[model samples]
Target: VSFGSELSNRAPTFDMDLSDFMDGDKPISYEKAKEYFSQDPSQKWAAYVAGTVLVLMTELGVQFTDSMSILVSSSVPEGKGVSSSASVEVATMSAIAAVYGLNIAPRDLAILCQKVENHIVGAPCGVMDQMTSACGEANKLLAMVCQPAEVKELVSIPTHIRFWGLDSGIRHSVGGTDYGSVRVGTYMGRKLIKCAASDLISQSFPSTPTQSCDASEEYEKYGVDLLKSEASLQYLCNLPPHRSALPY
Candidate 1:
């Protein structure tokens, strides 16, 4: 599959030649592409383009000799908490895969797009945006679990109900926002909680125990392991106000 682009009065200009990007008669390296994209602000989409090429090259174990062109026109507003980047990344990946005759599954393709966004685009993002864009069905909502990265359920929207997006007129970029710091803060919070629970356990259970200690007391005791368990975190998040000890 080959892509060709010609500039006209009514068309957009997009023409990229893979052969022209050779280094000493060999294909340009990913490192060189990364460096070139990193140095230019006008080539913001260069990372995504390089990411698509690199992923396809790695998967196929062959250099792309043909030139490809992409002309994108979208009405969707950029930023504003919307997934403009993910859409672009997914589209780019799909186009490249289709042109290269690579049979990439939707989920796998989404994962690749997420990796490109995170590593190449310098945006710390989860797979939600890419996955949804790739796998979403019409008139349905996708429920997903991020930890293991699986779709739990798909619920159909009621016919009577309509959904529409209203631009808030505020532009926000994930890289420019405090989103990365928020994620770091959450991890740090979990670590602090685990440490505190461990300290509490050490203070409560010493090597020398009282004579009153028995099976019943052991059954009632909650160890640090239990406190640090996954279930414990869920419980803490959902605990009732009266029973909750941790501040929000």
Candidate 2:
């Protein structure tokens, strides 16, 4: 979809039914389109991208007139550990941003895409997939810390070794119950560690200790209460410039 970067202003309009949206009306807001497509098992990723584009646009301060439709056809196999979902998301976002004349850097774009999946798509996935998709080069390894997506460097793939994606033969979804359970358990561990660390600090210190952190730092470190609120979650890594209406 290299053509996405060359797309003209405003998404091309298509006549779509109003009942196919969230409010059951003609104006196709991202939320409405997402909810509509989400009702069908076949259109799950469609819903994901639908929600993603609008939120991205909002974050960038683009004036959305609604009435945008996406047509996707992917060759990436589903139910594999492959970045199929991320491919769609990144492509859709890149396309929409291009059409709207939004100049998003690849790294920042990857972060924005992750926000869409975690917040809008309701998937608790890490940033590797989006980061790799957005910033990776051909025949190079993307090295990074998944601590809220810090890119270290891209290592060159050597001629001595070739990477292969072997099928496990068992179909899996990132949104599946097992995956969700693992994520829940990870966060649970983090919470326990936080409690333990807090206790250690209290026991060790003579004075009351308070961690000095801005909202962004706190969010990246823990993904705690600040990230739980919808408003804050939408702008997880990057706090939106306009926060006058934000509760935090």
Candidate maximizing TM-score: 1
Give the lowest summed-lDDT range of ten residues in model 1.
Answer: 1-10
Backbone clash total for model 2 is 2
Residue pairs in collision within model 2: 18-25, 22-32
**lDDT tens per residue, model 2, 92-202:** 888888887889998888888876776556566788899999999999998997776788999998889888788878987776668766766655444444444443443
Model 2 scores worst on lDDT over the 10 consecutive residues at 1-10
Per-candidate TM equals: 0.70, 0.68
72, model 1: CA deviation in Å? 1.8
Against the reference, the lDDT scores of all candidates come to 0.61, 0.60
Task: Give the C-alpha miss distance for residue 47 in model 2, angstroms.
Answer: 1.3
